[model samples]
Target: MPESWFVPTIAAPRRPIGRQVFDFDRQIVVMAIVNRTPDSFFDGGRTYGLESAVAAALAAAEAGAGWVDIGGVPFSPDTPDVAVADEIERVVPVVEAVTAVSDVVVSVDTWRADVAAACLAAGASVVNDTSGLRDPELAAVVAVSEATLVITHSRAEPHVHLRAPRYDDVVTEVRAFLAERIEHAVGLGVPESRIVIDPGHDLNKNTLHSLDLTRRFAEIAALGLPTLAAVSNKDFVGEATGLAKPDRLAPSIAAAAVCALAGARILRMHDVAASVAAATMIECILGFREPAFLAHNV
Candidate 1:
């Protein structure tokens, strides 16, 4: 049992998790983030070109990424036009290239319906939306594709959203936001099987709020849907470790390990290789593997 939160419906009928939205058939799958933008906070512009994007995707697959989330724009509300076609052009090639080569699931990271549709057409299995289904069209896309729709909770984008972020209780606020978004998407025809929840971290968030949410990942898991945690080497890591952006590897690994133990199903990470290693260690310690270590050089 989790100390932070408890299951609301203790007697609620159980649903087999084998074929859930994110598919818990496997243990602690990693979702590597291949940001194809010029300013995606971390690892931006690293996969700008088609070759680099393809290489990045292949690398993630090689690093044991159960899924790779290919993102284009940085999701900044202040950003200019960014037409649907441009977003597709930026991510479609990567999607096609990666999906063509790897059997691992590929999730498209975008908020626009058109972009998500195009990426799906190009071969994306899930839609990772950061706006919490604020866009009706995004709901429509998810409804039609029935793709795993990851809805993240965020307050009114204080600066660009024409409203301020006022939260008497951030945890309750985020949970309510995701609940509403899930209802909205299901109302538009997306099944419960297609919904996944992510508690937004770092993006438009203060350090304390991020820490609280990270520590309370069990509460997010209590939502009954697969939880995808996107906390890979963001400012929150720096806040906790006082490490610069380049030195966030340890904090990122620690955060991902904690989330995995707390029931995070998907880890959206920048360091797929290191995170995979960390997740494997956590799995071993969690009694998922035999407690034995052969001679492997440190």
Candidate 2:
């Protein structure tokens, strides 16, 4: 267990998502996945259309997710490249619709600057750069907008498969990479509070590497900044438990529990309801959140 947990001082000034501000110190933000791509590994394009995507976002909010990460492209190299205009087309309407109807924070999962700018304009409160800022200009767009930036660590460019990438120390390297990117984003005028770091578990790492990062997640949280764990149905979790994508929810929630115990503040997941329940339990255990109704236990 960590000596100190949920340190609010490490987060940026309250991050505004429309009218709501997320206080990372007191909240475990559940960012529900809403992939607009037809080829997403998890959903198989279930929310590919505008209406379905908007519905998905609203449903997640209803299920207790504080944020919805809408992505128009998959990071796998096997997935085809989406044109900037088409990417914008796929996400903007969803962003606009979700923001219009729900108070949940909307985050656009894109590595393209143009697509990011358009989504931010459409009312996304965050830009989740899964490619590790492959497009240098993406940071500038986030810097200028009221949106926050999620800088993840990926060893290769978007869509390129990383075959057994080596690292002297996986945790140390991820921490260093995220630190540099955070500094770079701040240098570009993004406030430190408006920035969050993700170690990019399966984004560029193998099963063992992701497991190590999750186990040593306390080190990442020690940076005193909000860290995001996007472990929902990821290959690492599947590989670890021999579960397929649809059946990985149990292990996914288990990994999320470990992440929460290690002090990770954000959990990006596909099963919003289950993740919220698990996170709520973890939060209560950590004393960061109290039980809904204290009865006999009190």
Candidate 3:
């Protein structure tokens, strides 16, 4: 493995998400993805049902995930817009089920304030807005709920694609966008300690842009907030390695390790067990965690 350089300059030492506390200074948190959408790119609607989504969330918690992100709508522009009521119905039940059984932090992934508010009331502690707050009211919802907010960098509107997205410097632009969004959220009454940033790996960006963001992710981390890396099974990983979505685990893990080494505090992933193992190993290697056994050295 390459020499680990996982030092972080986070603005806060601990981030409270609902009932869970993330000590970013000492750990790399694995936030498992539980998509409630039937047409989601990765799982292909595997966990779309309420029972299945709840099971997946519990399974992820059992597999050592620190958080479970539940999404009711796919971010792909190809999918039709889901009504606010439908979106809330799809995700809130799952959130209620998971939070009732596990202490795992639950995050509702949506760009709509109404959906976010409903999920927060249903026990979601984090609002993972991949749209970069296109609906600014979402910030007020998070602020009122005192929930953590993940400000992702995406240039396009929700469910819309940017025609030929361009950035003079992908990393710099992403960093700036996240900073501005964080300021907006704080202004709406959200605290900086409850904020996180994501560079939004492939959302509105091509393969080259996503790769560039991953290569220089530390710059995003330098913004001094908990940086989230959502690089699991993304198109950029497939494009770079010529592997299809189902076969992208190896490259996905590699990309996640790169991001972790680059100072990412949270990893949003689909394969919970594998991701948890990778994160634990990286933590041990970086001296943040001690090995479980020392039999070989003795």
TM-score of each: 0.87, 0.95, 0.97
Q: Which runs in model 3 stand beyond 4 Å of their true positions?
A: 1-6
Cα lDDT tens digits for candidate 2, 1-298? 3553333345463566656777667678899999999999888999998899989899999999998999998888888888889899999999999999888888999888999899998888899998877677998898888888899999897888888899889999998988888888888888887888899988879888999999888888878788899998899988899888879999999998888778788999999999999888877886777789968956
What overall lDDT, based on C-alpha atoms, would model 2 receive against the true structure?
0.86
RMSD in Å for all candidates = 3.9, 1.9, 1.6
Error of 1 at 86 (Å): 1.0
lDDT of 1: 0.76
lDDT of 2 at 163: 88
C-alpha lDDT values of all predictions: 0.76, 0.86, 0.90
In model 2, which residue pairs have backbone atoms overlapping below 3 Å?
A: 12-193, 77-159
Better of 2 and 3 by lDDT: 3
Ranking by lDDT: 3, 2, 1
In candidate 1, position 262 carries an lDDT of 77
TM-score of 2: 0.95
